[model samples]
Target: MSLLREAERCIANQGSHATLNALITTLQHLGPWLERVRDADTRRTQGTSKSAVDGRLIAIKDNICTRDLPTTCASNALDKFTSPFNATAVQQLEEAGAIVAGKSNLDEFGMGSHSINSRFGPVRSLRRNRDGESLSAGGSSGGSAVAVATAQCYAALGTDTGGSVRLPAAYTGTVGFKPSYGLISRWGVVAYANSLDTVGIIGKDVSSVREVFGVVNRPDSRDPTSLSSFTRSRIDSHLRSPALAARATSPLKIGVPLEYNISELSPSVLRAWSRSLAYMRRQGHTIHPVSLPTTTLALSAYYVLAPAEASSNLAKYDGVRYGTRSEGPNSATFPSGYLYASTRGVGFGSEVKRRILLGAFSLSADAMDNYFIQAQRVRRLVQHDFDAVFRAHQPIASGQPETNTNPEKDAVDVLICPTAPSSPPRISSLMDHNPRASPLDAYMNDVFTVPASLAGLPAISVPVTVESTIDSRDADLAGIQVIGQYGDDSLVLKVAELLDGRHL
Candidate 1:
């Protein structure tokens, strides 16, 4: 949190609009927002309690509901729309005295990977090269990540259905923590994928994210998907073993998934991965090789399942029942269904349209078993792979614990790997469809991140630099991801601290 104050001071002293412009969403009026916070603080009643985040200026991803600011997901579909209530997460922060900095930008409907599929225009990066060339800020939570990176806010809220939070954190070299699904309530947030969508926190470092996570990680009755007290007790009882407690101060077992060492991994990333592993080994943590065979199929299954869910979730926005109605007639003819068609046609962006079509097709009777069912099967397999590799069992499942017969060869405490295959590509390359970058190219960035999302595991991304210098050495600093079993968020953040902070 202090780092954010330092960033504010730096901005004030330097007067760097370039840094601010690359991050601020043009559709909203945003700034340090100190005056608002001070006014609210003065109105506080005596004996009113405040948590660690009191008086903190925080940014919310535009997708999250906020009563004060408009909740536009950088898409025309919900443009200039204001919610009457705040997201549970937002409400919790405000209760703790955190002020809204602004609603940062994101991909339209949380669809695109590069934040360019927005009516508000793509989110620009604060990262620049020797020639002052711009780079990507990642997406669909790119703007939230950039806000934290530029020191525009103490921490920002983002959603990660499939690496939306992690990828941006990696690209911008900030800390992004995607807690196990259901840890934070998602009731007020716009739905992307009901099952997979998770509200995440982005900060300059692990401490900020940890603090934010502490404030918001609680169950809410509004969100049926939110973890219940019974589930929390289950998670606690399952993980409160003496062995787990003993490992707190002991060396850890870190797994290096062989499948993640794909051919597409850049040399810079490879080097950073190797060095981080070496560092852990030197710290006495055993580095073991593990395999999640379904890793490669995760992205494919995610696209199928997520779109299928999106199609169902977005059905309400027909302009008649939900979306913005057009002033003009529905169509030239066929007045009955024209309103629905025309409103959706104009309201949704190309990417949103594409996913909806794909989702509808997958859910069709002819393709349901072949596509949607198959994708669900793949998702289950992905989850099974993680379960098989983790030392702990699922919090809610009733089963005999899987015994690690060999103490020296037990399941890993965590999996350490690169967050993305390569450093962020230049923004120009991502925007243009030249041979260097195509429409499909952005999807590849999520290759390393989708598996964790599919499995609902706790994952954290922290910046780690490579020892050997290479091309684009500055940007070569990559995010090393630490993933743990479900409900192992504390351990995941503990490892994130080890990698990013002086304290272990």
Candidate 2:
């Protein structure tokens, strides 16, 4: 079917799903591409295409730039901004004949755990089992998750700085895959944290996500931090090793991080995790308890490091360059600095400003050594801890011998854990009553998901069954996260497929 026809079908059947009301923007932005469906048809018929993703409809998170559409990052500051060029991933998709459907809404600059921070409004969950109580589709990537869950697009791209993509997928009953950092280029993605930000994929299942990944995983010259060809080859070699290849085909050992069983885990989530492990064991995979000792400190280090990088990345948004400009009442009295201050003060949301200020304070000379530097050290420790647990070595370009090895010990193929500590909270509860919840409490939502992100490893969230008394009308979905070594994306998807009882 043509992309246009798929879009029409989506429009026709959209009401069947309970999606976020503020999901789509103007459809006019997609008109030119919609008119060229025949071009995609021609490419498909020609059959000798170099691009694996030809003729697909892809949804983009609001933060991913597309020359033809607005890249708002769900922030008021960039509300009127549109990029002059496509993001590296977008360009690759288009080259492969994928039609850009429309930009999906998201938490402001990928900040919130719920899609509530969007300027367009919160993205509602689509998991309506039957009494339509609104549930949060996990945040930052909530709109992307909802878009995929509702079949608004075949696959949607999201950015996972923390658990943005994985959490939403867990909440909405979809597949969310965060590739190893630097595997996919991030040249045109609006920066939240340059180091931690990674483009992720959300789809109805793991196969769809793998198909999209195959198209966009090439290194891009535009992304300075993209992994080099040398590193890619190294990762491939590790995966191709005869013993590793054999393990990949058979039921391999999977580790359940001991620290993930925290007090915050809901009974439903705990039950689901246990059930998933039991199912894996029944399938012959060994489930073992693993220790990631540094995990307790990951949230704190991430909050500091991510914001610190964000503070530096966002400095370009002064009134003189990009983003909104606000004229202070006393602009004439202080022409130079007041405009910038007023612009940022008025344009940025409260949470964003709060983060920016916190980041700036941490980077200040007084706190640099004590906070920022210490946070960096903790970040390294977090990565080190992951490296110690994973079987495969990170393919660094320097050609250094892989160290920290325990020859007698064998590492598990993948790590299994809960995607989020609990089920989705009511949007109203989060907005109105959760004011007493500290920022730290909010950050904890990504605790189980971040260590993989920090380590630049691929991870996926797959929805598992949960027994609930909450009305059947409200779809109560939860997920278990499966993490793989770098470049082991295929294995992760296979495991998710096995657990979800979907054909791989």
Candidate 3:
């Protein structure tokens, strides 16, 4: 069997699987490597041995660097650019025997909540249902989610700065996993917010996502920010302890954050959440109401912090070292600096530019003390709030005192919430109406997701069934997010599986 054959089989069997509609263009861009994978039978074999992932077809997000493919990050700024080196995660996937299928689309620089910001085009959901109405596939990882959902690939890699991975997974009815920050190397990924950006995996199920994570979760010396071996070991040791292991076997205590139940949540989402909680309760898991007061401030804080970091990180693209350079009409009259500004202005999408400007302004001396510093302070409070509610204590560095003194007082092992406040909006509605509305309306899409991202926690979004009448679409998918303490990624996946009835 070949990669395409296997993918075709998946699509035939799985109604909501990937649609390779424009894959010819991708094949042309990927060249010979694409041909090799398409023709090789050895690449499609599946097993649990060292070669388990060998020959497996995998999709790479446009932002994740691949030496053989163009890494545009869904922006025209790098439309003609191909990376010289693979992202560490991409290299790991290849080494594990996975074949790089092609680059998936995304919101420009991972900025948009809906896939609408892409230079390539919006990625539509694979969940067509009976209605035949087209819906968003959640973004900025929407393309990756769609690829996985539609069987375009066995699995796909996406960068999750906030809810990019989980949101799309929810929309497309696939599994999206954002592992503990720094667990996977960020080395070849185009930076959005260096501190918040994480490489995520989107697959057909928890098992596939876990399998992919197992391959890429090792520490990379190249990523200076990668978690150290000692820290990884410490986390593993704690999670494997008899107490934690036994707790895993027993029913878990899941928390429902009061702050997450905002007014904007659709009635369908509310019903799905209620049913999810009811199901968990019936399964013997204890449900508790937890308070994370600072969560209300998370969205505001994230906008401030992420943009600030984005502005600084994006400063490298000054028409000099990387990205396309625009030589003004007259090179004699227009010098280096002048052309750089115009080039960036023309190249980046509106959303990206908006963020860059917001970020740059936040870091300005006048606003730094009031907005940026306050946001950082609020971010810490958000993290503290999470630590205060989870059962496990985050392992602090040696000689660093445990900040979570009230760990014993916390209510649950993990938190449960809706992945998005509402269902996927039509692409036309988002583009025609949203842009004219306040930028904050667009930012609201990240509300349920940003709190977890700000706390650097692991979260997963699993689709739940819903009822809908739009084109009689059978209410195909609704997302329920399961969030765990930092380093408790395995626990989050387990709980998500349990909730989805895959574990039972």
Name the top lDDT candidate: 1
lDDT of 1 by residue, 328-397 (tens): 5663346554646777888898889989999999999999999999999999899888877777666654
Give me the candidate number with maximum TM-score. Answer: 2
Judging by lDDT, tell me the better candidate of 1 and 2. 1
Compute the lDDT of residue 313 as modeled in candidate 1.
93
Model 2 residue-pair collision total: 4
Off by over 4 Å in 2: 1-4, 13-19, 22-26, 29-32, 39-52, 128-132, 330-332, 335-337, 397-404, 407-410, 432-438, 467-476, 501-504
- TM per prediction: 0.91, 0.92, 0.90
Q: After superposition, how far is residue 61 of candidate 1 from its true place, in Å?
A: 0.4
The worst-scoring run of ten residues by lDDT in candidate 2 lies at: 399-408
Cα RMSD (angstroms) for every candidate in the order listed: 3.5, 3.0, 3.6
Q: Could you tell me how far off, in angstroms, the CA of residue 302 lies in candidate 3 after the best superposition?
A: 0.3
What ranking emerges by TM-score with the best candidate at the front? Answer: 2, 1, 3
Clashing pairs in 2: 113-139, 130-472, 130-473, 131-473
Query: Which consecutive 10 residues in model 1 have the weakest lDDT in total?
Result: 21-30
lDDT, model 2: 0.79
